[model samples]
Target: MSITWYIHRLRAMGPAEIAHRFVEKGKKLAARGRMEGWSRYRTSGPLPVLPGLADNLASAPDRVKQDIVAAGRDVLSGRYSALGADWPLRDPSKPFPPTIWRLDPVTGGLWPGSEAYCFDISYRHERTLGDIKYVWEYNRLQFLQPLAADAALTGNPDAIEAIEAAIDSWYEVNPPFRGICWNSGIELGLRAISLLIVTSLCGSRLSDATVEKIRTILHAHQVWMARYPSRFSSANNHLVAEVAGEFLISLAMPELPLSGRLQAKGRRILTEEANKQILADGVGAEQSPTYGAFTAEFLLLCCFAARAAGQPLAKGIKERLALFSTFIAWLSDAKGRTPGICDDDEGRVITLSRHEPAYAASVSAAIAGYLGTPAKGPRPPEIELRDALLQAPAGGPAPPTGLRTFAEGGYTAVRETRNGRDLHIVVDHAPLGYLSIAAHGHADALSVIVTVDGKPLFVDPGTYLYHSGGEWRDWFRSTRAHNTLTLAGVDQSTMSGAFNWSHKAVASLDGIEDGENWRLVASHDGYRNRFGCLHRRTVASTLHGFSIHDALTGNPDQTTEIVFQLSPACEVEINGQEIRIRSEKRWLATLSFSHPGQIESAAGGPAGTGGWYSPRFGIKLPAPRIVWKGALPPEGLLTNVHLVPE
Candidate 1:
């Protein structure tokens, strides 16, 4: 690890987190029998349940019950799917073997199995086997939902028995404060929420002993989260998830002695963090659309849980939730695909729907259902699940439609109907990220993502991997990875570590013109510090097409490269200065540039530096990227995109 990473962690972590690490280290030492002094915190008394909790569970729509049961059956039959992998569940009745931890589902490579606890293993350092993301996927315990759901829905004693057996096996092998599963507070929070959901679904099917074990695990999770809350710059979506889990545990199980304190603390943290983490315009502070959606879902759960417990959220929080939904609605294309702006792990608060994580429409439907707003597009089954859980009504006043701008969030959307075809363009003119770390932000300051009649043309190459520590990680976050201009072959923001950006580029929206056509002008100072230059981009949309102009303020002689990354589905044919872009076997647009420059295409090669797109985590596909290289004259460079309808 670099000194920058250490300094980042030191600043981002709170005093409690520092203390918690010492305590956890001691416990790990004791577990290995290397230390004689260690202490374990214990919770007193039995777990509590709030009034009407059972009634709320019973009130789930009959359709939801059927879905849960069917999903559970799918899991039991060894057909559970996650992260684009279909893998069979090991027999739940047997103990979970240590070998399962070494298997990387994405690469089909397995590390040498180790009997030592996972916490002691440096999974990231074992680079020979490739990515270790799948290891965390396995530890997420996502399959627990289906098992608990099946146990509850069928009222089958064997199903409940198997569920308890799996829990027992996991507890036996993984102790508190140890293992990769315990490494992240967000993971622990997610597990606590999942356990609560299972408990809610299983109800009377669970044995007293099983319930006690579950409660014990929940108590441990609460303690861990309390000691190591994701705070400071590190507090992005992770903090929202952590506190939401704490809130769910406190709200769902109130009988425990610490429930009241936990409840109050959780609520307070959520309320304050929601306001802090969600920008005034409803964009998540992390600035990734996928993570923004994830954070919204987390908050929605808290909202629903609190309401169900007869403790409604404050009016401000409710309005903020609605704003979040509205922001997503505006950001989504006609097909409901959001621009993958930053890091996306395909993470979900809960898998209520079987739809792929990239399907932003499903998320919008759920949000619309919860807020009682008319959904902007087709509703998915996930929306029904949200309605069933919240008992919220179907329709309300429709949200405002048309072009919108969020100044604070530094995003502008241009939506119009040209030749009876819907056109949408999203422009980014935001900071590198939220705070000191900017952990999830990218270096694409003036990048643009465009869709015509619901088909993506110019797009953002989504984040493929993190912690890989190679060209792949750096390339995905680079300015060249986005639809923007790169000056002197340097990033708009300086990279301090994998997640930290120093000497950050600051972007500002100069002005917006909306009349016969929509126009936006923005500039960034990322190059000023190094090259004594400023990058200014002007985007204008007319009835038939759109144009982008790239200019430099300080140095007109600087050599710059302008890139437009095409969506994976797009096929490009270049003829002279005009490039034809096609998707789904039909021509989507024609691109023309004014400057006499060399155009090159990038597709992945042995070097792994080329045109590639990652629609989901751990999945990369070849894509066409049009790169224009030349010196910037005083007049600057201009590229015009003309939309074509089939």
Candidate 2:
């Protein structure tokens, strides 16, 4: 996020995107659209009954019901802890619910207040404003869903009163088109979903004045989204979320005159974008599984919302949605935890279950119910509430119990039982990311991840920061941060900003086959520009562990650094050419290199480059990383990883 980085980013855009930016800039100058375009239009139709579907929550399990009610009671006490990814942004003080909408609760800084047009606000330039996501999360008002759910769960008039007051307060503080809260389209979409959830669940419990006020607010949001969309390179998950918001608004607030128009528009664009943004194999084009889950949930929930409105999507739409959850099912471990591949803001479309594993289960349940298939795996508590929320039929096939290849998406999962060990390995040969900027992708082409019997060993160091991170962002996103080969000490892809990758590495997956166990053959030309070589790797699975063969096909003289990032659960010790990686009781695997010249284990260094793991967003802890440095012979270099018994 520097001037130079901005220049490179602009230069990276295509002519069409450049033209769109100019058009958007002109709109900004004119102060047109985006919550300021026009007054509330005329009303029409019976106010949507779609939101009434939330009444079904009465059928949800008592455990989930009690948890939601308890969370709601906490909110009633002026504390909102039903937070997702952006938890650090909230103040731990009392009388918190009435806290200023524009306050950055973490830094205690007042964000550019109601006087500033959202267009002119420079969140990146103003460190005092804090991360924009933090403000957006607090302002999203999603925490109110449980309040509304509580009201519906029982005849709790207090929850209803709190929600009405909060809405009235939010509108008064952050007016239309003014302040940082109105800055992004995705924020509007997210808040829209939250609003509908509240209104639908609370139903007649909310005052008529409040219901009409929500209808007006939702209409303004759709007007902004329709006028100024996330177009061109920006059309990733943001677009999906925006359209989903509009679709829900149309379903929940049919009184808005534009409801019919937006419903049609939302469905068309969602269907089109679903095919465009999601691979045929069901992986999100963004290359980040966390973001993938976020996107899939948006589309999936929107699909359900449409159904609840008595408007089902095409058969193909549900088919593609099935694939989405299937990929998520495969990526997740035995504990329902899925490792982050690229960036993870911990973006949740809605937070019924605060726990990540439970969140995964709920999404899995929704997908299963929609398809009327058996669930991918055993689920934790709270699935009943999610099933109630989606109104989907419950079932999906279990996560694969054997090697599975997603050739089109460039991912291979080896999830199976071998030699009495439940081994799970996720290999990445995917290109940087989805489109031109490859926004969420890291320079981690041809990297590898391994979990033996559900314990992480070789892991992808999760995304620790975005936007505010400086050198830390670059370091965590580099080739050096992943379990892959680096030639001449350079990343596989070039990054200009936290979200922008300038030069991208083209990764090709040669094959995924079974011979001696399962093997994956892949290569990337990331270093070919500088070193004139293609980094080719062949990962062959073993009964015990891995037989990895690496080679430089185009050029052979460059020195290579093969890094293996270990899980924080692991303890590493090395002697000579071999390294032993272990957890609590015993070593999980023994690792060694072919013709190693120099090797070292890095942890808690002064530079802070290695030995770091981010369990969640905004948190990073020290973990060991093994770096192997040497030149391979003209022939090749081979690595052997043999499993150790407990």
RMSD, each candidate, Å?
3.7, 2.8
lDDT of 1 by residue, 1-646 (tens): 3555667556655687677666867765665642211124234444434333345435766777677667666566544455555444676545355556556665667654324454566654456666666666666666676666567556766567667776776665556765566767888888887777667767457777777777778777777676666766667888888888777877866765566888888778778877877788887778887777778778877877787678976656667766766777787754456788888888776564244544445555666666666675443333323344444333333323467888888898877776556678899998788777788889999999988877888888888777654678788888878899998778898776667776679999999988657789999999887788889999997566889999998654666889998888888898998999888998888888988898887776533357888887766778988899888777888898888865
Which regions of candidate 1 fall more than 4 Å away from where they truly are?
1-4, 7-66, 86-98, 101-103, 107-126, 129-132, 156-162, 352-355, 358-361, 376-378, 381-387, 391-401, 606-608
- C-alpha local distance difference test of each model: 0.72, 0.75
Q: What is the C-alpha local distance difference test score of candidate 2?
A: 0.75
After the best TM-score superposition of candidate 2, give how far the Cα of residue 31 lies from its true spot, in angstroms. Answer: 1.5
Model 2 error, position 602 (Å):
2.0
lDDT score, candidate 1: 0.72
Candidate 2, 50-102: lDDT as tens digits: 54357557766676678778867766765443223323333433233434677
Query: Number of the top candidate by TM-score?
Result: 2
